[model samples]
Target: MGRSFTVYVAVLAATGSFLFGYDSGVMTDVIESPNFLAYFQTTQTSAIVGAINSTFSGGAVIGSLQGGLTMDRFGRKKTIQMGALICLIGAVLQSAAQNLAMILTGRILAGGAVGLMSMSVPVYQAEVAHPRSRGLIVGLAQQMIGIGFIVSTWIGYGSLHAPETSQLQWRLPLAFQVVPALVLVIGMIFLPESPRYLIEEEQYGEAMRVLRKLHFDGTNDEWIEAEFFEIRRTIEAEKSVAVQGWAPMFTVPQWRTRMLHGVAVQVFTQMTGINVIGYYQTIMYKALGFTGNRNTLVAGLYNCVGPIANFIFVVFLLDRVGRRRPMLFGTLGISLALICEAALNSQNPDGQRIGYSIGGVFFLFAVSVIFSMSFGPCSWVYMAEVMPMQIRGKGNAFAVGVGNWAVSTLWNQVSPIALGQIEWRFYFVFVAWNLCVSFPVIYFLFPETKQKTLEEIDLLFAQRIERIPDEMTQREKEEAGVSAMNVENTKLHN
Candidate 1:
């Protein structure tokens, strides 16, 4: 296989991301369906609607937390395959639901699968890609995520209008998501395991063979030797670090700090109100008094456009603009846009500004582009890249699961309050959330991981190796318990 082969493989793995987008976005349309209220029997008194909406997030949390262990133990390919199967099952269950519980059950199962994919796909890609092209290749994961959002938004909105032919309306859109999962399962059967994973498992010959395929030039023995050593050194280093399970992560300050960094990034991504727009755009529009299906249609169209724009911006400028500046600049843009949304929404009452509501919707969508191109995809890349490869699965899983479910729960819990009390002012909380947490996380805690090799990054946390301090903060002091040998170990293979 050529470089194209690996790229295509990444594309296939990333296709799982399409399902992630679809499953996540599926509910956006469901909320608007006439059948949705009757199907769930939502009422002012009933908590079922919130339960129905939050259950999937709850399930995703379970899935994401489990995904890291599953990926490490079972290998990325099998874990992904399992996730796909789960997705298919969830789709069938949701499509066949007669009551709220059934639909929620289906969503829970599907959401879990998506949660798993969100963690696994990038881990797999990062493990396989050549160091030189790593950024672009890993970035494809985000690109697919954008595509996934766009696809599901369209499906959710378009299906509402589909002529009633054997339930081609809403059910068809939900069911159709299964096709991608099914294809991923079949395709993954032939897909190779991460070469690094194979090496860690002491399947060196197989690892070498896989590397031969990934490297594209089989004759390059020196490259193979360096790659092989790189894998081996990482495994040896992990042995000293005590990276397994929750114990190592919690006890070691350095480990815990890194984990916290992961959590912070994930939390920041959510606080940006990315999901608020992606999931609840229709409801938000309705709050502005834009009635009928047109609001949903417009919201969906915005999602589709935003991702395309995001893909173009991040894909091209990622190298040129560098990580810190674009993310910081973009965060400022999102905050400003969010403030505008909050202000616009604030004006809706007292009939003070019926004029601003429509403009606010447009502004919210504009904020979507800022998020999609900058924080949206780039955040995932930073998360996967920053964590030490040893506990990457757990770190990523924890961050994503916690972040996603937290947002889902927050939105479900507070959306009603926001709608009921200060509907416009509701977003103000998120604006504050973004400004306070996001900026510092980027400025203080996070490192610029772009264009660096994994081993070089390991040195950032090593004791003896003193790299230049980032303008943001001192090079994080390696914890006391991290012995000389441990530092040596990280330095040896990374």
Candidate 2:
């Protein structure tokens, strides 16, 4: 096994992300369905409709917190499987619902499942991937998410062609979510656990074997060995100092700073208004003069743009360009696009001008493209990379749950109502956030972590004590404190 094998495992794990994307994106079409509205007797702006979206996110918040514990206790692979199984159950409830109550329950359950997967999948991918390709590997989370969005939007569009009276118009897309969830559950059985995780469990022999399998390139045994020992030494150092429970995350200054960075990146990611656009772009298109099937069709095309842009960035630019620049530039770009959208929407208040409609749609697509290349993948990568192994599961989950889902829940609940009551004004909120808050925070605070191993990332946040050389006597090793070879390596890499 080599790079290809690592990629294979990463992609398989990303099926969890696909489910996350699909569940989130499918609702855009579901609520738009005339059959769904008629069957449930709810309009798009109804509080019930908002409840449907918000409940899922609310569930995810819970799932994310729980997933952190589960991932740590059961390993990454099993946690994903658990999430998929729960997703299957949620899909069934959603597809067969007879009233709003049932569907909302399903939405909450599905949301929880997504939350669990969201926290687990990226951590697993980051831990397993090679440093040189880590950005590409971890970025797959957002890439798969984009694919999930594309599939959901197209399926939702196609489902609209079904008889208006047929529940299949909404039910079919809801049901289709099970396919990927099922695949993730079964496919994970064959994949290996994270080597970092294995090391934490004191399974050094197994950890070494996994590192070799994941990184072996016919002649990189020396590099692989070095990485294995580096990981083991770092983990040992962390465990020796680690306090039990989640206290250290908040109490320690370095850990607190990392937690803030992780949480802020995710908060900024959601505040960029990607989900608001993804979940309710049909409404935006309607305001832009798209009617009937045109709105859904354009939404499908809009969803397609993100994946292509993200794919290009992940493969060609992510590691090369590094993280900080893309985020800084991406936030600025998203702000500009939202401004254009607001301006164009204001101009086409009646949705009568063809030019304004085109402009509005263009800017919408622009938001998706810029976000895909920048914040969409980078946020997940940053959160996963910043945490040490001792706290990664809980810390990443907390960031994703509190920052991503909690904020997402607020926006998803309010966006439709805001669009109904305030119209184009809501776009400005995100525009202001991007310009005044998100961009500056990223530029001033975030450090570049490109092409560095996970152990090396520790040096960026705090200074480590010097380590004795391997050739030193045991007494000398005890006298020298813990490992600091990575500090010198960090300097050399810089």
Q: TM-score of the candidate numbered 1?
A: 0.88
**Residue-pair clashes, model 2:** 0
Error of 1 at 458 (Å): 0.6
Write out the backbone clash pairs for model 2: none
Displacement of the residue 62 alpha carbon in candidate 1, Å: 0.3
Q: 423-493, model 1: which lDDT tens digit per residue?
A: 67777777787778788769876677766666556766562122322221122112111223332333322
Q: What overall lDDT goes with each candidate model?
A: 0.72, 0.90
Question: lDDT by residue for model 2 over 1-494, one digit each (tens)?
Answer: 89999999999999999999999999999988999999988899888888999999999999999987998899998999999999999999999998888898999999999999999999999999999999999999999999999999999999999999889899999999889988988999999999998878867667777888898898765576668667767777777778877788899787888988999999999999999999999999999999889999999999999999999999999999999999998989999999989999998999999999999999999999999999999999999999888889999989999999999999989999999999998999998899999988888889998888988899877644235323424443233232335223422222
Candidate 2: minimum summed lDDT over ten consecutive residues — where? 485-494
Clashing pairs in 1: 455-494
The CA lDDT at 137 in model 1 is 70
